[model samples]
Target chain A: MSGVWGHSGNIEPMFQSATAEAVEERLQRPRGWNRRNSLPYTLVFLIVAYLGVFILFPIAQQFLTSFSNNVVGVDKVTWVGLRNYERLFEDDDFWFAVQVTFTYMVFVVAGAVSLGLVAALLLNRKFRGRNLARSAIAVPWAFPEISAVLVFLWMCNPTFGVLNIFARLFPGIDANLNWLSDPNLAMPLVIALSIWKAFPFTFLVILAALQAIPREIYEAAEVDGANPLQALRHITIPEITPTLLLMAVLMSIFSFKQFTLIWLTTGGGPYGGITETLVLRIYQTAFRFFDLAYGATLGVSGFVIVLGLTLLFVYAQQRQDRARRR
Target chain B: MNRPGNGLLLPRSLSMGRRDFLKRTAAAGFAAALATPALAQNAKIKIPLVSWMWNEPGRGDAWRAILAKFHAEQSDVFIEEAGAPFNEFTNNMLIQSQSGKINGALFHTTPDLVVRLLRGGHLEPLQDIVDKLGIGDKLSAAHDHLRIDGKVHGLDIVTVKFGLLYNSAMFEKAGLGAPASVEEWVETSTALTKSPDQFGIYSPHLMSEPGDFWFILQQWAVMFDGVWAEGRKPQVNTAPVIEGLKLFKTMYDKAMPKGTDTATANQMYANGRIGQQLIVSAAVNIWSSSGPDIYPSLRSVVPPGPSGKAITRIHPICVNAHASDDEKAAAKLFVEWLYKPENYQELMERCLDVVPPYPEAIRQEYLDKQFWAEGYLAGKSITPLEIMGDYIFFNQEFGNVVMDKFSEVLVANRPVEDAMADAQQELEKASERLFEGFTL
Candidate 1:
């Protein structure tokens, strides 16, 4: 019997050895291969075919569509090579979208990660109802995005919102502060809502990493007269550097592609496309204006920007991993 | 014989029956998957309709019941509903148009969208539908907006007339009557306003999706006799337009709920805290549902301005040009069935926001059931058909320019002249680029 009790403590290593042997045997043989290993080969073929049809094909199609005069819903395609790109470069709206997108990404990434790290540190400490606190912290992340957005929109109402009601108590704050309509405050409020919705996953990840750290290392550091701040700087910082770097890359990617939060709240308005992110601009160009080719061009440009950032972060992470190993 | 990279060889002792069974199962699954769509294609004459009306509460069930009745009457025909949220339906139509494969045979959308679809040549000519019905003389003046080159392109089901919808209770409480001109309008709004709690007026002054700021602000623009376009050329940045922009800015500052969009404004108005607003005829039903006492006290007047005109829009139904012949025939049949006098007025009454496009629809029996009948028919001081003089379709080109520049002026507090000039230049550029070779 291969059950745990029957095989005793050494079963794991034995199972690993058997898996290695099976792989070696499979590699060494060549005759009747289709009949012998049909299942895995069929599974892999299915996966590749699925990805090629749904994922890679659309991406390639978009790249080709960007150069053509494919006016949406019309059965005509005129090849207009590089003119779409030229137009994209010249358009003032495109540049404004780029500037706003990067600004939004930076603020959201920093705010979400910092808040997440703080929450993680607090929850990691031993206390009563710690488990309950951990569960409660995840509620924001689990909340439906549309529901949260609607609630926030109501709360930010200039006339009768709870937020405006509270603001009246402060000495200098305008009682009827237009949080969403004011161009100055709209983006900040959008960013705060995004941070609230996204920080929980970061909190959970950081908490797991924190719990994995050796208690003995912290105890020794304390015995040597190291204070909490010193321990955090020398021990916690170095230990969690990899996770932090990873989270930064992921959060940056998420922020750059975010559409629903910003679109639902501001829709690039209160003024003329002031809050328009690249994704929102692409949607407007494609669906609203029906300039399909121009929208595709904008999409490709955004993809390149995000891909470049991702590669840079990955390279940095690799360098850090090498330094840690040394 | 096998190649090196082919990996493991099967033992000669392995059974062939198991392998055959698996192969047969996979083949059967693939065949079944391929057969489903083929079977659907040949089943019945399915006429699907893509519309946002199904998003309304009672309308969805009414639509389904109508379709069921049609199906029962015509056993060979199937009516498929492809209803979605407004934004999603618009997006779906765009994608379908790009792919040149429209899923629905018929579609229902606003006049603005009808113009866009017509410009793209995505709509089938509905002149035959009108000619056969012989209701050309009965058609309202608003149908002029749906005609292209003397050919009917779509059929109007319902329309919204823009006017001043006021809470009579508030007006009485403030010892004010409905305003007749621009100055009176402002004075009444200010008199009715009592800071922080009760706003005198509620309209979406911000650029909002699903509802453009222009829809509300255009009433003011038209009242001031500002022409948005003459032929294909932009006539913005005129003196009248500048005056209209200034009036809107003042209204925003003195009366409107700051930073509120249409949804918020609608909610506030429904709660009876708002005094008056530029609202559509359909909103009477919406407000009535929220406050029973408020409905009885509600009153409407053609909002006064220099020209004494306001903006009104009609939503229309159009057939997909790409639909198959059978589907098109079925769609026509369904529409004919839908507009039979008994069915048409009953459906219109269920949703009080929309008025039927036919003048005959306002027959005494229909008005008796309509909640806004007094404002719409009896007094008839609000002349929706003739008040605006001509029915001009608000196309995407004009909408984009108006919404953006107006937002900059109203929300950003930009100088009216500079902003209007910017809007004029943008409109000219768009016309030059978009309408360069097209027949307007």
Candidate 2:
């Protein structure tokens, strides 16, 4: 255990044994006897308590609510075990919302990350007005969501939207297009707005990650007769793959819970919930339809989907880490 | 520490010991605690009157004047304005109610919202106030839904009935008189439209504004003598509804400002760009201020459809059951004062409202003076409860299904019959779960 902190070739086993011994010793000590050791445990307990109240408790409430007949204005809100879940499985609209949520998540995640990477790579180079360019790219992220939606609504307005100006530049689009009302265009327009509002954040994070990579790595690749593309492929990409993965996970979560932008813009419609995500559906069900029990059921199902996504991403990350080590 | 500028030692009396400072602070806090109720008792009972009308253009000012008059006349109660915009108001109140109480001691409820609140037991019955005012028998039939177990739970502050409100100036420009039939209405609208500049008609169709969209959509069905539901059964796939939707689609394609939001469309209407709107009569007040030029030319007609019936909705102001006894009493006092024939008539005249909750609530002389009232008065009145049957309790939900499917007809060019068939099936399926224990 003493050699755990020493420069040893067998460091992993020594560290594990030392950790085990420390835990055993701490447990054997009288409560509050070791203030230094107790500090970390106290902080951990505080965090757990915070999470339990703010996150876990509400989730538990929603889970309990999912099994009840708790609709607003109902005569009795008695427990109706498994009834809501049974209905969920047969509900077509709920399934459509799930599909829409995933589609939105994928497109937004991919679009934001790709656009972020491109912008980051471009801005990372030595260029004139680079600072100004970086500041400009961050504007969208800084802008309030409601304001952005308002501006976007104005720009996509059928009669007077500025979007029509650019749209009519192409032949055969002679009339002002119904940018959001058209079912074919609603989802795409909403996705584009989400990406625009989201990509700036990804750009800032990816830029910081790019700056963290040593310039020597690129120089080393250049000295070995590597072209710019080869250097980018071998040196730059490999160094940032982990950051990109992390961004994808973060973006997925951001888009998964996105409500204001979608709710404000298309309101989960042009027709038949073309843009309805799980969040919007939960809201419409609970607030609009006054079906709290079913809304909770939908929420629980969404929580499961999110949990599955997180586990899948964790597994992928673990595999990637193992590959990196190899 | 030395005092600034003077550069002299501070007086010994200026500094106090920590214990003395703590004692003084605690004494001040204790004094405040003791004095608070006395001060509050002396002050007016500041119970907030929550209403979406507070955010509306003409209605807001009208209500504010009424509130001012109330303040001038009363001393014990003070009503503060609170609530969100029209679009968010119902859901905000619903959310508040779901959490055990509404946001304010007194709040306004839409035609559908009062029913939910009444069933949820969130309303304090105002039958006593009505009886005191002796207007219970004079109350319009629209107030029937607000009754539960023989007690009136709310008092209608405004009764909004739909009509084909059009700009006679625009009609004159197009050399078209008011249409006599549905086919004539379509031809007139198409003829009046000059795309990219002016639209012939605008009824809220955007899903982004489902509250307005669904509210107006119900009237569209009514225009053709159709109801969305009957006895918890949907009549969406029926012939009259199909005809109503087809007419809407034809107008959408040929005459509407396809993607314009209601606010912008209203501005367009004010500016004489939109020729007509199937709007509530209460909305006429907006033109008096915002569209002074066009307001004079504005005239309403019975919807030139087979039915010639308009859906009349009553927005009621209710006292919160969850409020304290003092607050509830104060709210009821305000309601009683506002419902007096003189005050109510003044409110109607100030708001330029044509409909009244009771006959004596309005003056025949005032009605005669309103040049635009003829058509609104001529139409047969149908309440939402009658048109929707038991589904009136789930008005927004029923409207959502209808609006969602019909959006396909407007957007994807899906046939109205096919879209409506899908809607009929969806509604049929939803009824099983939505109306499990619901009694109307």
Candidate 3:
């Protein structure tokens, strides 16, 4: 070929430059787009519109109503400017509701996350009928809340409930135990039910995180003379720490807003507002008493507190990320 | 086709006449279309009537039948029964009234709730309707319970008398007679109770359900001649009130099922485990229908309180303030028909235990029923229409306050005196808040 066209090699540079010019000319021209290009923009607009109509508008209206006086059997609303908040602070029932809510949140979050972690660890290992066991564990979460609550109410009945019958079999335990009506036992029972309902989500999330860790790392640790405990501590724990933090935040939010199970079971209780949380208080204030303004104030206060905790969680996550990067 | 310049076209004068005829026809057709709806409306009047009685299975069906009859008789007027369960209907009505959009032309509620609604201007003054229908002469003296400041705002469709209801089988099994006084009630309850298997008495004692709890406590107070309020001010810490509360606590501890609500307790009663209940007469109708096996064993008598007084209520109904004038007229006509002797007898017969205040409606044959013996009928003479004076005007919120504190004593073992004192304070605060500008 070189002998056939000795001058072809000398023209190669010119050929390459001409091809480069053709590509540059194409790149310089504007792109022609069809309707397909607008898909992402349309999706974003739809999402924003849905959030605005369903979520943001109601929240903003609630916030505004919190500052006004909307009494029962009256239509006129007068701007009172934090008077409802002032009154809420002075109200004894409000404080009791706060105490109940915080206590419930702490117990539920700790119990759910700890139990979920234990469940995740068990499910991650190979066992006989392992899939069946995992499915069985999710049964409570899948059961409808109201239906489960009714079953629980029956089980906790003093006379005919199965729980009392079981408790009686143990020595020194009273057969006529009023499980739901007893002030001392009501909150604990509520917390248990909430954990039973919520822990499955945490379990599933943690299990996914656990399975994603490289098995080779554990095998390598084993070859280097590290035991199972040491490997779990140094590798597994650190890798899944972010998932645990996020689950805790999620469970806290869910427990704080719990209404149906608690409302249906004891209706905040056998008396003395023993099990009434902030959300139950808000419902009672708005629907039962028809004091929408005060209820809105309570809702707003709960929202602010939850927001602050979420921000704290975010800060902790950022610090962990920075430490890992370093 | 004919052109304007064609010789075959119509003359200008003849074309103008034809255009005028077409215009008149079009105008007439438009006017007829517009007037058709008005003509149909004038022919028939439909009034929406919402009833809390819809929650009562037997009574709801009975009332529907009566409304159907009225619809048949008055061909021009119709009653549309908007059905909702009692609790939901009450809440929805209150909300609708407050929102200035009452859904129905007429509503049936308890006397106390009616008073509060009247004060809130949710009910129209029925004085005109009452006078026009001659209802004042036809109605029993119990109708006075519906008046506020000399204006009749409601009419009583039915009245309930509260009394001691005992299972005759249980009484026979325990070898105890009916309780004739508060002490006897305690003794009878204690004698009949055997934990887990059977219990002595049943009452709705959950403070969270304040309305029912307050009604029960009001009955207790009335029996002891104890007053919780004098006009607008609260008198919760008085000796009689405290004594009555102490009695309640003792009954809860010793005889009644602890922490059991009325529904649970009624289940116990229906199963023949409960000895007695201080229930309204109408409850017998429900118990009989649900548990027919226990019907023969049930007997009722006026609750023998220490004061020789009893608590009863006149179930009153009112026209909604938001009702149109035509709707109001139809509603008044319906009420008038309901109070007529022949129609009233039919209503009384349909609702087994509920007694119409009208003498002609109270038949001797109904009194002979196992559940409605002479003992239960005796209360019609002395049962008081008004309860605890201005307690009716205290609204449901005041009851909530009292019940909240009332719960502490029953659940937490707080002293009756302390709980009553706390209740007094809370009631005063509530009264100051709820009844600010009006006289109780």
Candidate 4:
């Protein structure tokens, strides 16, 4: 029957196209939309207005005020043309800040993702107390940022901290490190804390992607005489590739905006601790210094930097996808 | 003890509007109120303070203590103080303002960006009320920071300042007396830094504007020979200033710790590696209170620069221009009461690190135990007015740039003079732009 009168197939492209056209027409029909159904549009309008007034407007106000020529201590603002930007350019601290923040973002994002992937792979397999362990792993994420930081701080306290106690007990660690005070150690410690706090998020996402992998593919690989280590190499990585790409893009943004842990734990100590990220600097500039113009300029640069990195990631993925599709 | 008691008092009658509860009076006549009036009055004043809950005495304790006392003074009106955390104070204040739950707020200093509140017309002006109460002159005569635009808006019940604290042992070792002139100070600094164990000076060369940079720079600029205009515009290129920078550079090159930088000072100091710190006199108590290992053998002195005239920065308690009328009135009373010698003493005792904001408030305890009194008194003035003959306005924004730029130019190997000139230009622009036309 020539596959039920199909053009070399049972499925008819014409019918599918015709049905899609009918639905499109029905959707676009002016009279078909119930005039009484105004709730959806009203909801949309309200959401936009709410965001504009509360969130968007404040952001715009900050951008505008950053350009202000108002005197310090007096709240009166006037637009100053690029003076803030010019000042920021010459400011030595600004350049150093740029270097510190960019470095933190690079290291944290790369390090966290790498470690997260490894942790995800470990947890992906079945083991005794795997369920309990999976739940236990998320405990760090459950603690509030400040509370977790407080505990971490107590652990890191130079004089009588638990970590120091351990160091002393072991007699292996030479001298107790002042985790909060030493500039050399502070940023890396913050990065460590951030990674600890953040990896759980990546783990959850990766686990989901790992679980969604078809069991049969692995069975097929095994049937083809693929070894456990070899099958895992080919089967696991390709399956969760999309999720890994999306997470890299998303977490890169998160690391760029990672301020609170640093703000609370260190408050950008050690005279602008190795800890002040772009977000911290922007916050201090905009809120503390009240240099909205310079703040905006820094913010814009931060935005460009973050967006460029994210786009590069996305573009790379898109190109890879296209190459595979081709 | 850190947790507050769960308690509330009802006035004698609920038959009236909630707003009218202020009129309800206790049965005790004025004479009867005198004996145990505090307890009864505390049971009555319906005012409550929203504050932060912390272990060490933060700014909230000062406010809480004042409110607790106010409750005793006004038996008919009770003041209840509740606290959250400092991190959430602003957000909580915003929410409270929205719900109109705030009777008044307790703050150490007026918030910087109060324009939003002023725009909302949340603050009540105290001019007319001050005139009626006849407390205006009494308050400002003691605390000048209360006036905004010649009108009263905020008040400081307590204040503090950074005073140069030195290691007298180091001074003795160097066989150098405190320098009264720029030349003497530079020479002293150069000699003191011959080794790693000691430093001639240890001050933040860079800081956020409106920070300690102004204090450090004030000590330097005046002695080194720099000046600013009526607008607080700094003239850094002057010969004295150049001489000062040259000395500072020489100190940087020959004397000061080779590895000194913004990011390393705390560690360096904690390691018992620095000799001088221009700490707030308040830190004298903290230093004494701290564990001996972390604490350095400390003494206090002002920068004996070339001018021999010592100048430092002040953390003045200013009034928020947006406080409501009743708030303004209550706040005025608060400020006045705080300045009363007894109340001032109580405040200093509670704040621990802080001394009374005014020189008039200084007493035997401050003189004997207080670092500023023990150390930095160079022809003491009773109030800040005495210091004003040698004053430079602290610009928070400009100070921020100075600190930032200073560290960059020096630690990061940028040219010192170029960094200074660039810093001044940036800060001046910031001062111009951030503070366009303040008549003050």
| B350-400 per-residue lDDT for model 2 (tens digits) | 899989998888999999999887889889999988889888877778889
Q: Higher DockQ: candidate 1 or 2?
A: 2
What are the per-residue Cα lDDT tens digits for candidate 4 across A224-267?
Answer: 99998887789898778878888888788998888778876665
DockQ of each: 0.27, 0.54, 0.25, 0.10
- Which candidate do you rate higher for lDDT, 3 or 4? 3
Candidate 4 C-alpha error for residue B352, in Å = 5.7
Please list all clashing residue pairs in model 1, or write none if there are none: A73-B97, A73-B98, B282-B353
Residue B90, model 2, lDDT: 79
lDDT of 4 by residue, B1-440 (tens): 13233453444343456556544444335446676766655544333344443333444565568657755665544445654565555445444444443435433322232333433334444455456545555553434433457775444443344455666656776687766555676687777774545567666443222244454554455543345333455555456655555665566655555433333554555545555665555555444444245444466555545443443333333233345545444554555555566666666666654444444454665567543344455422123333222112334444455555555544445666776787668656655544444444
C-alpha RMSD by candidate, in order? 11.3, 9.0, 8.5, 13.0
Sort the candidates on DockQ, descending order: 2, 1, 3, 4
lDDT digits (tens) for residues A260-301 of candidate 2: 999989999998899999999999988888888999999999
- Scoring the B chain of model 2 against the true B chain gives a TM-score of 0.88
Question: Residue B115 lDDT in model 2?
Answer: 87
lDDT by residue for model 3 over A248-298, one digit each (tens)? 999989999999988877778767788989999898887766678898999
Q: Residue B174's C-alpha lDDT in candidate 1?
A: 88
* True-structure lDDT of candidate 2: 0.89
Q: What TM-score would every model get versus the actual structure?
A: 0.84, 0.87, 0.84, 0.62
Give the i-RMS of model 4 in Å: 8.2
In model 1, where do residues sit more than 4 Å from their true spots? A1-30, A73-76, A165-171, A223-225, B1-46, B61-78, B208-210, B288-291, B339-343, B368-401
TM-score of chain B of each: 0.80, 0.88, 0.84, 0.64
DockQ of 2: 0.54
lDDT for A307 in candidate 3 is: 97
